[model samples]
Target: MAIELETETADGDDFVVYNHVAPPLSELDMQVIKSVPPGGNWADIPLSIAQKSKRIMQIRKSGGRTTYYGRLRNDLPSYTVSTYFYRPGNGSFVHPEQDRMISVREAARLQSFFDEHRFLGPASSQYKQVGNAVPPLLGRAVGVTIPSGFAVDLFCGAGGLSHGLR
Candidate 1:
């Protein structure tokens, strides 16, 4: 079930494709995405503009602190993927350059899932599954102690551990 992806690289188009698909962004989502600058978040927006949202207004009025409505820098690792990643206010889920939320495939890659690892269910469900996953690198490190040829994953969701075990 591996899908080939054609990505343009410095050399040329990379022919490696990933099986993962991302959920599409809505028009409002696109609008919200365009409002963010690279490595910026809703916090960077003018107070007048952000105040339209009750959530932002309440947070500001309460004098509470939050890293929500932020963006990830291209040079840095992503914030912990949360189940609510569909909302930009939940975390820095926006693409560094693209004006949209990070795709399911991107999230999977961040979690160290192989390109061939496929997720089941709807897009939102896929995001939740990926967000709740243990990083494959950590899984590999933990798997090193298991007896050769015998491995078990107690809470495998998207096969991060099982993939690493292989």
Candidate 2:
């Protein structure tokens, strides 16, 4: 989705704004976006052209493979866009296409984490961190209920809730 900025002539006022309606995704992209499996890969598509076409092999080798789980940002155009995917397992060295899991960066993006957010540790650790994160958007929405005087996070994961509250 795209957003536009508008200004008023009478007051010479500047304010950020948005359209009341959003453009729709292309039908094919919508189909692909809808078909994503929970904890599974696009390869799980039974009749997908990606699965049936011989090009699957080429894409596996060249384009490589990644999962495209939906992101919370789908609901908020002003937020950074992101999505997530899970890998098959913890094994370190699997074929690019057969890796069975999505990368940490991919998972972070799925959670609307910005490209500049630095994740710590190796790939496996990064994936673990991403998997454990709470969507900051959700946290912010929830933070509104906290009392103004003092707030406490209970069983918060990775301080995502705290970060949002602050």
Candidate 3:
């Protein structure tokens, strides 16, 4: 639940090159993100404000998962990290208390990336890098579950699972 950077950064510890910082939100975006609370989702937004969104309107009328526009809960495991974690509309990427999406480093922490592992490139690419790869801890769990057994992983990217198995 807690994370630490491997080294000192220009922005200090909580915020490194790819940590703590979040994208700016539009006025409407701010309203929507603010409406949700810890463990709350799109359904938590007031009807007046929620109806403004074409997608939210559709989901409201028809039906959809509440995962959209969701915030994290301290007592629960984090929702799976996705490539669009920088966008709250994409998933439950919002911070429980802050009115912004989780930062790249936060996503990486959820994905169990090592503190020493640095991601370079634009923030977008950094997010993708964090989301696309399997968590090293998950890989280690899989490896431990079937000790001494041969397994072939198809289309494995980053090979964290394979590496952990070895």
Residues 1-166 of candidate 3 have per-residue lDDT tens digits of: 3333355665665533445457667788889999998999888889999877898888777777879889998789998888888887888989877777777877888999866678888888888898898999999998788857666775379656567654
In terms of lDDT, which candidate is strongest? Answer: 3
Q: Which stretches in model 1 have alpha-carbon errors above 4 Å? A: 1-29, 63-66, 145-166
Please write out the lDDT profile of model 1 over residues 81-165, one tens digit for every residue.
8777667767788777766666777788888987668787877788788899998998999889788888567648975756755
Best by TM-score: 3
Candidate number with the higher lDDT (1 or 3): 3
Model 2 local distance difference test score: 0.42
Q: What is the TM-score ranking, best to worst?
A: 3, 1, 2
Error of 1 at 101 (Å): 0.3
In candidate 1, position 49 carries an lDDT of 64
| Superior candidate under lDDT, 1 versus 2 | 1
TM-score list, all predictions: 0.70, 0.35, 0.76
- Summarize candidate 2's per-residue lDDT along 56-129 as a digit string, tens digits: 44544564444322222223332222222232211111113221233444445556665457777654555566
Superposed Cα deviation of residue 88, candidate 1 (Å)? 1.0
